[model samples]
Target: MRLSFFLLFLTCSVFALNIDISNSTIANGKTALLEFKKEKNISYEKIVVDKKTYKIFDNPINSEMSYVLLPISYYEKPSKKKVELFYKEAKKQKTKTLFFKIEDAKYKKEKIKVDGSKVTLSKEDSKRASKEYAEAMQIYKTTNEKSYISQSFILPLNTKITSEFGKARVYNDSLKGYHSGTDFRAKVGTPLIACNDGLVVLATDRFYSGGSVIVDHGQGVYSCYYHMSKLDVQKGTIVKRGELLGLSGDSGRVTGPHLHFSFRVGGEQVDPLQLMKLINKNLLNK
Candidate 1:
């Protein structure tokens, strides 16, 4: 990945600003880390990228800095995108603009065979799935404005990866969609842990995901663990890193038992491994 840093100073301003982006050219379905720093007294309002406004969170490692995670959707077209920073300087709002490039990701195609009923859901199952999707979307759209994570994120399980993120999925000769998450090899009763500190916003069994748990790390960052056989945490539970959240199994629409781990940053589903690396380097470990 390509990294870029920009330092700017407004004329006669009280402080100088430093902006850092994890990559100047990011691949689709990946994530980019954006950092802003100035004097301790200086504060930022929000960030604008690709016509979307995202909230800036206080850097967990450095109190003088703020950061946001930018996720490029897999469906986003390859092009040059702009980032606009909005801040206040001496009672006057100022803006700074930076540009980045998005390239196509070379994701491999995958074909898998599963139960026919899983691929073609019945009418009742389809209705249940739609309701579950809407509920999950509501949780992802709500930003808590406060961060629960103070340290770097960890993987939910330490196992071989069966399927990687962003793979084009062809289920039973029909193109369903791309894999939005990474699948880890697990047995019927393998333990699953929370990736980081978060509040359990949703914990329930659903039509497609089976037993699912969605954690809110706050500031528009969420982690999801899907297809579990058992849920150890409940909604409204505050979990720490490495805490037991559930047990993996073949509970959902899958060919085998595994853990599907994903991330949503700024309301866009991104590659989990990519997001974890960037966040640790640019925010928690900075």
Candidate 2:
């Protein structure tokens, strides 16, 4: 009888821990931060939202709790999505689900009448693009156990945005797809800066992306720079916030000289500016 009573008390205490979204409702292309409290030492197993794995990490400076920055896709529809959190419970594990609501966001559509040859890929270019995409996707899909990224992310370019994220993009005469990254109108030699403190994971010129760079800033987060005039960093190089990366230029399928910046969380591409805003509030470096 005493053992049974003690177990009941333990169960009640463990279930008292709190885990909830900071915002109940958020616009598409933004983010939702999951804050955990009352549980000082816990291990997060996995977090799945809308069938996609979200990134989960412990606060580097604070050991009392952890956070998961749920990346809201820029094109996600206005609907309720289910989020399942698997976490440590006692000597075993437990699960919890939350219904997250997403709102629609109006996006601008733009058409570029670029050279037809630029839009249509040759057989050689197609093969190369396939390989490059495969490699990039691998980096996005894998999550590091430790957070490599520092505090809030900085903008790669501070100039006016020529194209916005989630914008419906039409190239030449056919639909290309939604613009996954924000574009900045830049000169051929306009310098680009690193978004945060991260390790250069991939730095090479691709068939479609041109002089490209991918930075792994830990915590299942990554930032990409595309269509650069030059490559200044190499693979495995650790960079600091606001460090010079390369120069912007017109490359690949673009119509003019510009810089493309994108952010990825747990293999999903999200709005870079939106990510910066979300990080500024939840995960700034101390």
Candidate 3:
């Protein structure tokens, strides 16, 4: 794990604020943990990064602390970025700016051969896929302020990883797009589990994803499981860590049976493994 810690102290009229960042430099398609602590009462306003505003949520384990997860998309430009933190103390508004470096991940390329129909959807199929995508995006746009899990995130499958995230994918000699999720090798009917405690926001088969499940872990963090053979959970069901989710198989636009796991933090698709490591090491372990 490549980890860097930074601490900054800001003196206010009636309180002192301490800010800690887990990583000083982050790669594209990765996440960083930002923590804030205060000696007295403080109201966190928001966090602005790369001209986008992210919500701040209270730390579940520590009442005096607040934190937010910063996600860098796979296509985000590699350069130095500024993060602005806004807060209120003693009826006065205060702000702080922090800088972090974003570097290219340099993901590998992959070529796959699946059914031609899956790549070129028909009119009906295209409409259905578009509707499904819009529904999923709606769920991701809303952030639950309260976190559901008090422990570190776990892997959905304990098997070998078949494909990594952020890989440029080509289907049938035509460049499609990048792989937005991590793929794990799983046989048909292989039972899968939830990575952490959360509410199942979406559980249904779609035109492109097939049998799919998405969980909201609160505070703008969501985990997605796609291309499942069967879904055991339903929408609005609350699940615990390591609970049964469904069975994995070759579904949707795929060449074989596997589990596709990914994450969205603050509406940005990120590397699931990297987000898990950051959450466990910087938030849960602290």
RMSD per candidate (Å) reads 2.1, 5.9, 2.3
* lDDT comparing candidate 1 with the true structure: 0.87
Model 2: weakest 10-residue lDDT segment is 1-10
- Candidate 2 lDDT score at position 116: 66
Task: Give Cα distance to truth, residue 272, candidate 2, Å.
Answer: 0.9
Number of backbone collisions per candidate? 0, 5, 0
lDDT for each candidate structure: 0.87, 0.78, 0.87
What's model 2's lDDT at 104? 84
Task: Point out where model 3 deviates above 4 Å.
Answer: 1-16
Given candidate 3, what's the lDDT at residue 75? Answer: 87
Which pairs in model 1 have colliding backbones? none
Report the alpha-carbon TM-score of model 1 versus the true structure: 0.94
**TM-scores, one per candidate:** 0.94, 0.89, 0.94
Local lDDT at 46 for model 1: 85
